[model samples]
Target: MTTDPPPEPNREPTPGRLHRARTAFRRWRRTRPFWAAVWTGLGGFVIFFLPMAPLGKILQVGLGGIAGMAGGVLLMAMALLILLLPGQRHTAGVIAVIAGVASFPLSNLGGLFVGMVLSVLGGSMAFAWLPEKPARRRRPRRTTPSAETPVSLGSGSA
Candidate 1:
């Protein structure tokens, strides 16, 4: 009886679920203002948490704890809005900028200026983000024989 060789293992490994998930996440992030959302969220956290911390005794310069809290919450909401509705990024960015500015007088110096800077940067980034254009397929070039070239035959020349 003739023995056949075992089937060779696949040279290219198939992607696992984790890889697929990561790829999906990357695609989603690229389509939206991901970094902007991250920055705004962090800024909001800072603005919201600073006023409640012990450092509040030294950094508190706003109208009151309540105003700071409100401003922070508003900024955080704007960040979420930007992420959820990228088409409305302009509006959300403007709102976030206003909130960041307001936080200066409402929150503790806009969370010691850190939160305000982050919020402004995030808002601007969100406003500036644009979708990538789809790539166009190029047609293959066709070459024609040139008249200047002489055609060769199997017969030897004298």
Candidate 2:
């Protein structure tokens, strides 16, 4: 089979296309401000539900309510910093990670310790390799029949 070469790239917008596109975008950003606001509000509402979340759970775990607000704000600032560098990375995901790491010492130390020990033990026990069970010699069955099994079928088939 023959392979085909790649096609050439066409990189020009014709005439007033770019201008119209920019104008349309600007018009959208301005005219749809209500939708933008609603979306922003919805996003915040969703963020509020993050598990072991940076903004809420972090604040609650890290400090009391008044300080919780401050903690939440700081968490958001950290998220914004994580978000600054690029194409479609989630600061919240990173924040969740940090929160997971940081919250370790604050609560459930006993549970954590137990879980770690159990996990390690489980892994080691799982893979340390037990010897195969000693192969049992096949025992010759007794000719005597039990009452439950049909004696004719089991013992005296003609």
Candidate 3:
């Protein structure tokens, strides 16, 4: 049997799909370091416990693999958050960057700590920056002409 040739690397991705993909990719990449670090770190964590993880050998093995992937997702997720969150997005994004850097240590503990710190920072910034809406003013009550009139038409009193 003849082997099929591999697709060309230079073939351009379609603009529509490419644009969508680029958008998604940029989102993923922008948050890459965070997701990668987290996923990789978590993956390492799960992989290390594969033998004793009680989910059965299959699951344990699965988790080991998953843990490895967790680091990847962690980075992607971080990039994704930067894309998703607005306003203080740039500042919020640094957490992902730090986490991505920490991923080299291959430790989830580091990510957990960083995540906690970022969460507090995110909350505080949101609390401090959100503009409060002004209260609506109530209109003044109107006096009707009838109420001011002392004369009754039928009684002829003025």
| TM per candidate | 0.75, 0.22, 0.26
**Tens-digit per-residue lDDT, 37-102, candidate 1:** 888888888898888856565355546577777878988998999898999999999888888888
What C-alpha lDDT does candidate 3 achieve relative to the native structure?
0.45
TM-score head-to-head 1 vs 2, winner: 1
Per-residue C-alpha lDDT of model 3 across residues 20-105, encoded as one tens digit per residue: 99899876554323333333334333323323334565365564334434544554454345335544445544554454444444
Per-residue lDDT of 26 in model 2: 67
Best first by lDDT, ranked? 1, 3, 2
The per-candidate count of clashes, in order, stands at: 0, 0, 14
Residue 146 lDDT in candidate 3: 86
User: In candidate 3, how many Å is residue 122 off?
Assistant: 18
Best candidate, TM-score? 1
Stretch of 10 with least lDDT, candidate 1 = 53-62
Query: Model 1 — TM-score against the truth?
Result: 0.75
